[model samples]
Target chain A: MNGLLIAIKSETFIALRTFASKLIVAAPALVAAAQLLLVRLTEAGQQARDSLLGGSNFEADVANNAYGFFVDSLSTGLTMLGLLLVAQAAYSYSYERDIGSIRHILIRRVSRRSLLSAKLIHLHVLALLSVLLLLVSSYLLSGMLWEYSAIVEDGFELISESEIREEITLGIQLALLPLPAAIAFGLLISVSAQSATQAVSTALGITLAIDIFKGLLGGSGPLSLCEFPAFPDRPVLFTIRQSHSARLFRCIDR
Target chain B: MQALSVTGLNKKYGSFAVLDDLNLQIDKGSIHGLVGLNGSGKTTTIECILGLQEFNSGSITALGYPPPQLHLSKGRLVAIFDSPSLHPNLTVRQCLEHALLLCEKPKRSTEDVETLLGISRFRDFKIKNLSLGNKRRASIAQALLGDPEFIVLDEPFNGLDAEGVDDVLELIRTLNRDQGTTFLLCSHQLPYLEQICSHIAILHKGKISHSDTINNLLGNTQTILQLKTAETEAASKVLETISGAELIDIDTDGYLNIRISGADSIAINQAMVENKIPVAELILKRASLAGLFREITSEDA
Candidate 1:
């Protein structure tokens, strides 16, 4: 048990540090900052319409309208996370090859299974942490903006606390669920790839294919590979002022 | 006891046969030096023994466990390769720590390894930042972590300076002596291998051409002799005492160059002294591996 934990810790630490060490926590933070900008935009739109377009209901339109930008930012951040997985895994394997580290590892008492497992698990943890940080930041910044607008005057329907929390939680969960698939895909590519460029380009190419297939598959159905659609229906990550928001929040809470 | 036994191992990469009918037996507690020319399949053999390469046919038993049942020999068989195979993005400390964590046995504290390898200065430095020699040392340190029963090192001295070589050689000696460690060292450097390895296996064209105790193998092989004698007639007479000795035609300069297998300098010296032949100078030269390799391969061709 101790050895396993140590292995897990070492694997995770190396993976996280490798990704974080480069450019130093800037990319994910930048993504979060962009989402915050969207929040600010939504807040400004709400403020301008409070007097003319009615108070609470107008705020709902503002938040609902900003959903597209939020989804875009989150998707971009996820894409970056995917890039991180592909790059780190590819670099990890290729650099090990160059340095003869693979020989060293193979000659050790460790099983090939453990080595491969540690790598996949490590990469997943790193990707998860980056996603979590981005999601947390985006939610907090956007929530703060929504709260600030609530201070001036009551809109048609102010977002309740529980509703905000549920949306944030669900949004994060939704973003995180696809990550395992991405990591598994990345690992499959990394193992077979001889070079980092080959690994990254291949992984990106596959992601693009999935995106294209997802676009071609149209419907409220899950993004199955075969159901090719033209455009995706965006999920509203957060809601604003609506007259029945409290009741809706209560129903969702139940 | 045999530390490793490989028989009829065959491997092919696409159409190229990397290892064919390769057979070797390394005795426990002996340093077995594996020698070959470039593309002679030394690395491939090591990789096969280490269970890193999939063999097409044949069997390998290392430290009493068959491979690719390599997990059974986990922590018992370890190897280091020519390329200092380590994660470059990892600090020397991180590499060690991770390697330790991965080993079957609990890893010893890093302090001992750090001190032994004199890598304290670069413990915090990433592998890419360390010089080649330091990386090699770190690799050795990592290989030694599990107190393995057998170690296979491929061209470990390739990038080391004299001091680094001495340091590594000393460490290898200590490990073998203190722990009863068996080593299969692959190298093109014969002189260096002669110093450390008790047994030698010579590979040519993906086959084991010769394998024997280093001394016996060297003893039976012929050596080139470059001699300058004061009296060519007396030297020839003295040399006649040694059987199987041949005189290559001398140049305009009366240099008595002979190829001899059956005799050493002492025998010739005794014969000269006994026969009242005045001996001005006698030189016995050791043949390098390249000479032996060429002789073996060209004869095959």
Candidate 2:
């Protein structure tokens, strides 16, 4: 127990002073904010063209809902976060080993098992912080760009605000289930690989390969066990929006 | 008390033996030097002792703990490796502060070690930006933060300049004298080891061929006295009369090389003059660690 604590302290000391840890925590949030800004600019341009042509805004209610954009931004941020966590976890152990710094802690106060456990715990903490920031930034930016309300048509509510919130919540829960598994896979590669470069490249490569395999199987088969959490093809919110949008279009035709 | 002991240790890699039935014992509060050639298993032995790697069969103990359990000693054991094993991105001060986290009770502050190692000016410099010698200085500085009972240094003098070497040697002496700290240094620099080590162990062919105090090992080899004279036969006859001198051979340089055990050069030269032999040049070559090491290693070669 004492050895483990010392190892944690040592890991924290280096993490606080290093750049890689900061990169892992902040990069996802920054990228996600940039993505949301770009998306809003594109939407504004489209709205201008439609107004100039005097086109009918039949789908404007659904399109203008901030929930959809929030979910999209969350997906983008989560995808980047997942990759960053894996790469950082893979780099942490192997880089210390390559530099021979791990030997000092091993000989002085920490066992091999304790050192590895501390790293695992430290990476998980970074993941948690990154997720919190991603949630906050994406929620705030999406709300600023559009209104958070229900989908309505001609003074009659088609979808309630509570229903939209429920779908978005379900979609986010499904997207976050696979993150811990990703972090564990990265640590496993870190200990087994020979060098830091080899560990990172191999971990990222195997993760991407699994993602590709998951796609080829059409989200079915044993490959789904290692599914990429972000950017799911049919999130609950997207499915609900599509179903309602199609119903409204049919009503207009009638 | 023995600080470290390795008995009948055998380590083999894919049927190739790296260390075969090796045995060594280092007493507490003594600086022991392990010297060997490039391919010798010096580094491997240190790694196995530190529990960084496993050996096939061995019984090793350090500071009342096995290699795997050395960490339980709570910073009683430290090691400075050949390469500077520090984070390149961190400043020297930051690296020391990180090391302090592993120490159960640090004895010296970061500033103290930096000043002791003459690296106070480079405290804020990143390890990667420092010169190799300064990087090595920083590496040594971190090890001194804890009050270690036993320290292991591999190639401690590899990248140091002459002044840096002097500082390290002085530091080792001061620590050993003041705190009674033991050290096991593995290096190829024979002269530096001779200067600092109280005992020397020559690792040859996967085993310790010789292990003894410096005086005892060098005492086994006889000093050579070279004499140059126009009358080689007359000089040879006079040297035969000396009790402790045995004429080995007259080398191609026309100098009679005699191995003397107890006879001094003055006595030999005085006897040569009394015998009416005009000695042009008389040179006495004392036995050194290098000479004794050569004599031992060359025997098998």
The candidate maximizing DockQ is: 2
Lowest summed lDDT across 10 adjacent residues in model 1 chain B is found at B66-75
Alpha carbon deviation, residue A107, candidate 2 (Å) = 0.4
Candidate 2 per-residue lDDT over residues B54-92, each given as its tens digit? 999989999989999999998899999999999999999
TM-score of chain B of 2: 0.98
Off by over 4 Å in 2: A216-254
Q: Cα deviation of B137 in candidate 2 (Å)?
A: 0.9
Give the number of the best model, judged by lDDT: 2
Q: Each candidate: how many clashes?
A: 18, 0
Model 1 CA deviation exceeding 4 Å by range: A1-7, A20-30, A38-76, A86-98, A148-175, A218-254, B104-108, B223-225, B229-246, B260-280, B287-291
**CAPRI quality level assigned to candidate 1 from its DockQ score:** acceptable
